[model samples]
Target: MDPLLLQVLAAKQIPSIGDDAMLLQESMVELINSNPKAGWKAALPSRFSNYTIGQFKYMLGMKKIPKDASLSFPVGSHVANSNLPAQFDARTAWPQCSSIGRILDQGHCGSCWAFGAVECLTDRFCIQLDVTISLSVNDILSCCGSSCGDGCKGGWLINAWQYFVQNGVVTEECDPYFDPVGCRHPGCTEVWQTPQCVQKCKSENQVWSDQKHFGVSAFNIQSDPQSIMAEIYTNGPVEAGFAIYQDFPLYESGVYKHVSGKLIGHHAVKLIGWGTTEEGEDYWLAANSWNSGWGDNGFFKIKRGTNECEFEENVVAGMPSPKNLNSALSGGRE
Candidate 1:
């Protein structure tokens, strides 16, 4: 079946929340309930659960209007043009000795785009400057302005990067703000403003063009997503996109096993590591944005190479080609 039609059919099967916030909360509950060994065993109020469910539904494009929905990335934008080759493995593409950090949860806000962009920047920052700084997603989510989305709504990853380049990001604690509230540093105290954020490229004269010139790398993954996952885990967390499974069973205990397709929404996660299931299907260890209570200590593993779980290959297309960045910034081809 066509993926879009299949997604619509699957969305109709899930329960509905009155609004987006409630929808996301519900999804978190389902995610936690799906994983029993993680030890989370508390039930949430219907109101709270509804928020998660709503967000999930809206993200999947099931809702006629989003509770806090905003603009999305341009259509056809992705990191890869194809799926990974069948022979790839996690050990080869990623460096072994890289340093990764703990996973984070964005919680109720469609700030995954910011989280993804910041996670990538943090990794590169660590590699380039030899310092591990957990930069603030709140900063970008709060400050990037209308081109992305409001704090309550969704945003674009490229816009977040532009925000980062124009205004250097600070530690989460330094700015320590949240959505609905935004940046609270009192003027530009903790903010680092680069000319890149709002500056249009001289040649292309596009806001996004300036972002292309920044030092970001993109790759296409096929075969073993575990390897790319490992690279993300070892180097630092990577922003990954996933299709939300609606029928993803509820977390009555904390164990999740796919029963049928009820998945909805397109979510971005931080890849932390990888492990094998009892059935020997490889799963990618991911950090969710649903607070610490969800998943295996705010983490979950998706079966690799099945469904749209292998969408990591598409991430390559979202990356700014090094060659493109150079040419745009240098006024000519490198």
Candidate 2:
């Protein structure tokens, strides 16, 4: 073992981790040594260096779309993308929105569900109005109601989207990331508890903050490649959920496809676009919240069409009212 590798394991307390860490490391090392044609490198990156698949679940933390929410709205038929271009990215469609290459870190909270929905909403809202404004993932995570799940214990992207339709999220300035209570906070998880809605925007001084944000509507995409792609082309990006594997944390870069890891847990993310690799492999670009230090600078590309990790199964999207954009234009944060 390399002394540096041991140091990382020690610093991260990996020695006393779950049963799969050692196995994942062994597999990754052997595969890398073999030098396959894959574009990305794999190893136990810091994000998954010390944690097991079970603990990783907290980071992914995406619950199922509530039956009521899914059924409330009549299902829309899957739209075909046959007429669409072979390649389309929200980043290029509306550069004015400035949503391209945007990544977010959820810190220690299992609020991927909130981050995904809010991120998509933020992008679409910005694209729709052609402006730049950072919406509040903290607001969504803390106050979206029980319907979104145990407030960071893991929630559904669909639930979060619906909540946004009823009541959208504020900006990061209004309610910053509340790691102490909003989530597990990176190094600790022994005292797991569901946090309550803090409603920080309601502060006496920022009394007008609550009125600055609004959710206009929400919808779900059909579980088909064309449907997913068409949704991305039409909007900005869509919130997606899929099962993750132990090998995911080690992803360095490239079009990722499950090679050797086993079932870890379900995670939610923002699906940006699709592309075929130089080697002709198809992939879906996604934004992750594990910070810029991990994965492809806080983003990852997974195999496309096959739903490599179910990235297309539970897709959700949202709309923000023009009222929110007006507030943003006026510098909503007084």
Candidate 3:
């Protein structure tokens, strides 16, 4: 084993499986659970047992930008905090919109930038226009090209939203995500090449153009907790990009804080709501794209108000177009 790799395992307090075995979930769980002060629980998820340290790094693919990058999208609006609730959840607020609670898997791809955007937009369409549609994350990942980013390698969160407004995205029914190795399958660490952009839908009956949905506008929300809460309270869920630390993959439940480990990479998720834990820790609820088997059933709560993990910064969202919705139903005349 490389001495550097051994040092990393030592730093994480993970026992060596000997020889070339990298970090294993079992050792990580043992190390975490043994600590009485560890706020969150850890588990040995069999599905991720074979994941090497390198693969874990690639699993998260949300790119980072300068602090001033928010200027590109700008704050869409501000809301008064006078009536803000102590707790809120998008799933509860929009009970009819099943998309709000859906837990999607990026499936061995670093297309979290695309998954985060499409997931939030799918919920927004249901909340805004009362239309239920699973927008295609694949369309954004494979089709947006350089305008979005290097496909599964990583991408900008802002560009994903911008693509929704300018180019629009088709329904999942039209171009569903390609997952050959199911997310639940163990030892699935193969990185996928982005699928080629297919202009047409898989179902011959549905026209790709007619199945498309457009956004009216794309904007960022002020990083302040009140502002982010108000935006989701009124419009729906928003896409939040933040840095991921090595400790994050071990998260089970509790308001996550960077207790230990090094910076792994950046990742994006659907910022769905906020709440206060029984221990009085403030947290922002988010939906991750690692499927239901990870974290708190594909959901996580990170430290809120303080911008822990930089989750509050660079929040992005958009409005669905009623005009485009009607046009799609009639014909491709938008």
Best by lDDT: 3
The clash count of every prediction, one per candidate, is 49, 0, 0
Candidate 2, 226-250: lDDT as tens digits: 8888778876788889887665777
Ranking of predictions according to lDDT:
3, 2, 1
Clash pairs, candidate 2, are none
* Best by the TM-score measure: 3
Task: TM-score each candidate.
Answer: 0.54, 0.83, 0.89
**For residues 1-334, what per-residue lDDT tens digits would candidate 3 score against the true structure?**
3435544554757432422344345556665666555557776655466777677667688888777765756567684778989999999998999998999888878889999999998999899989888889889999999988889888988889889888999888788887644555554455657889988888777788787899888887878889899999999999999988666887888778665556768999999999998888889999998878888998999989888878888688988887567656654433
Regions of candidate 3 where Cα sits further than 4 Å from its true position: 1-21, 25-27, 184-189, 330-334
lDDT of 1 by residue, 23-91 (tens): 334444553444444332434533234334443443321112231332232322224424434333223
* Model 3 TM-score (2 dp): 0.89
Residue 167 alpha-carbon offset, candidate 3, angstroms: 0.7
Provide the overall lDDT of each model, using Cα atoms, as 2-decimal numbers. 0.45, 0.69, 0.80
The TM-score, computed over Cα atoms with residue i paired to residue i, of candidate 2 is 0.83
